[model samples]
Target: MTTGPSGSVLVLTNPDDVTTDLVLRILAERRVPVVRLDPGTDLHAGAALTAAYGTGGQRGTLRTASRELDLTLVRSVWTRRPSPFDGPPELDGQERRFAASQALWGVGGILASLSGAHYVNHPWNNRAAEYKPAQLATARHSGLSVPDTLITNDPRQAREFAALHAGAVVYKPLWNTPYAVDGRAQQVWVREVRPHEITAAVAACPHLFQATVEKAFDVRLTAVGNRLSAARIDSPDLDWRQRQSLMECTPIAVPDPVARAVCAYLTAFRLTFGAFDFAVTPAGDWYFLECNPNGQWAWQPGPITESIAHAIADQLQKGPEL
Candidate 1:
């Protein structure tokens, strides 16, 4: 691929990210300049950055193993999941911590300072949108239906919430963090929780409990700019992710109200891309579950995946609307 005279699309994601690979291929076909960098592992290894600031604003050059990107010439940036910054192995203890911190604020700050470049979903916005409480409140305010929910560390409140829902409550982790038991990695999948399960141990941290919606199926609605792709997922398990082999996905049209509400939610978060999950009841009501600001969409059925990739590529090629 060759750089175009216009500007480059700077992608910050690890090499193993297949989702990004799809978009990169489309960008290549369009002959748009592309600069892919994974700051975490690439910094000292094969990537270097030099930025300067003056009355004209920030300007710099980022040199990776295969490309040199002019910061001022960046049209847009895709803040995909990049690995955490790592210092050289030779440094340990406070030295390692110091080096990592410097790199984060230095290199990370420079990339974020690109003057005219638009971020698909800015890192700051992504971080803010990750809060479940904020999500529920924003979803409700945006005119989307949300389930009765509670976020608390008090066991009594948890028990009361579960009781009010007639033991039809589901427990969800606030954040999906990596865990392992006896050397085996495990995920805390969503599951039905009875009042008895609410113990004093819950006081250790805040837990999210919600009235389970009697759903006929689930929807994974992916939004890229103004484009939306809705995929209906059918699965027997409470968490569809637990049974990928048994799950089925098909394209579905978005209801007019749902579409408007989703757009409102995206605008509320100032995001250009989102992966929203919704539970549709037997009565055909769509209940907002949560939205992943930088969630995965490539795993959807072929057509949906292809459409998302094309939409993202189009946005990157066009940059942001002035």
Candidate 2:
């Protein structure tokens, strides 16, 4: 890709994203040139995207209905939850499948590989960080304590593992993507499990089983580049995300070791931003649960929202910190 003007930040997201809106607000105040693109919709619609290879990398331009973005001029990119590619309703099923693949790879690949662009948790890095097993292994490699986890497809072994953990095991999804069941949206929340709950259905697919962490409160640490801001969350439920209204969050100081470990994890996965979850025991132990490279932050219960917005805007404006 070719390098050109600076201070041009490209936001890749779906519509009605509050986090992106917050960053755009801050950017507007700073007079930064920004462009928003949703490839899932635009590429299949009237928009145009073109990329070409020269000597070094790729140079491209993406033109939406209202604006044209010079791919090489983008100094930073913030990718949020972009919707999946869905072809025109008239297309056949196989045709739609092919269109989805081309859109995902052809256009999406170039966007992911923008030259000289700083991504707040790049798409490739986000994909890797989303894997539960990869997160656990990376956390462990970073010297952080992770709860013992088992991804098994055996019903008897799952029961045995649950019994080994004194029945304090929690059932978690390896990937937390939501799907519709009977035309109703469904998501599997993390909940404590018993031996009897592991039935023959466990043989059909792999399930994530982990030893539960008995904790006083949860901590959500948002790391944007080198700036680490932590929020101590107290909730009555096993998963605070499900019981968000019943939770309280306060900005708190993170321990030095854990802070360093978080930074290392981001480096390990090549991410510029991360929302980390930790279970803090009463004894002051921080147990690493998972780190979402592109996790939510606008719904923070404390004043961390503005801080995060500022951090993201700064990161995108100034390019990533070395």
Candidate 3:
């Protein structure tokens, strides 16, 4: 597990993801040796009875971690993905819960044994960054403008906020939980909210209603260490995800103030990586929306992916000066 003259990175991720594939490729190109391991397999139990099912979707297994795969030598770990477990149907619901609890407890124990290693963005840091309200407040505190926002479970309050904002509010899910029952994908969009729709939207959860700025364009800022890259994303539709094909992204210079704010946000969150989304108003104002710590960057257009890969490698190899 010792790192060679060339530093090593352990990418703990699922086998079937574009993120892992892209990272592996980039690391190889830079001659940064990496080992990919499934967290589930690495944390498996030896004496525990386990059952494997299904071919490709998911598999439940009974296995154990080897002594050699100990956490001490792990110089850096990218907690990209962890596999899901499905136990045997024959086991009662309570039995399944007991087994799952045991697995998690074991995994926790293993993690507790580790001396700290540099995580590109640790899971806990990512979790803390996921809260939109926190992101907005942090951004504003760091000298970035942020749109007025409201989060409440009350339909009446939401409707009132929408009306006060001249129906120029947008709704976004607090967390990324995209689900589909069948093959079709469920659509979620960010657009001008109607006061009348507030009643129905409140039934789901506390809605995050915000004043929708009149955006001339959108920006995705990928911050790796102190280095940052801003891309201007222009789309025909209100939500960029909807008209992705029509969207054109180009490298743009981030204002010094904005770049400094981003660096502050990163330091505040103790994160080495972050993907920040901003709403650029027609008035030339950039309003901070949210930051995703474990955000998707490989799919970012053009040299963005390459830039991030190099940035990450630089930090690992040069001892975090950047």
TM-scores of the candidates are 0.96, 0.93, 0.82
State the RMSD for candidate 2. 2.9
Q: lDDT per prediction?
A: 0.91, 0.86, 0.72
lDDT of 2 by residue, 268-298 (tens): 9998899999999999999999888888888
Model 2 local distance difference test score: 0.86
How well is each residue in 62-176 modelled by candidate 1, as lDDT tens digits? 8988888888889999999898877766799999889989988987888777887889888889989999999999999999999999999999999999999977699999999
Candidate 3: give its CA RMSD in angstroms. Answer: 7.1
Task: Supply the global lDDT for candidate 3.
Answer: 0.72
| RMSD values, in order shown | 2.1, 2.9, 7.1
- Candidate with the greatest TM-score versus the true structure: 1
Q: Which has the better TM-score: candidate 2, or candidate 3?
A: 2
**Candidate that would win on lDDT:** 1
Candidate 1: segments with Cα more than 4 A from true spot? 1-5
| Per-residue C-alpha lDDT of model 3 across residues 49-136, encoded as one tens digit per residue | 2332355532222233432333444557676766644333456798877766665565533432334457776767777888888888
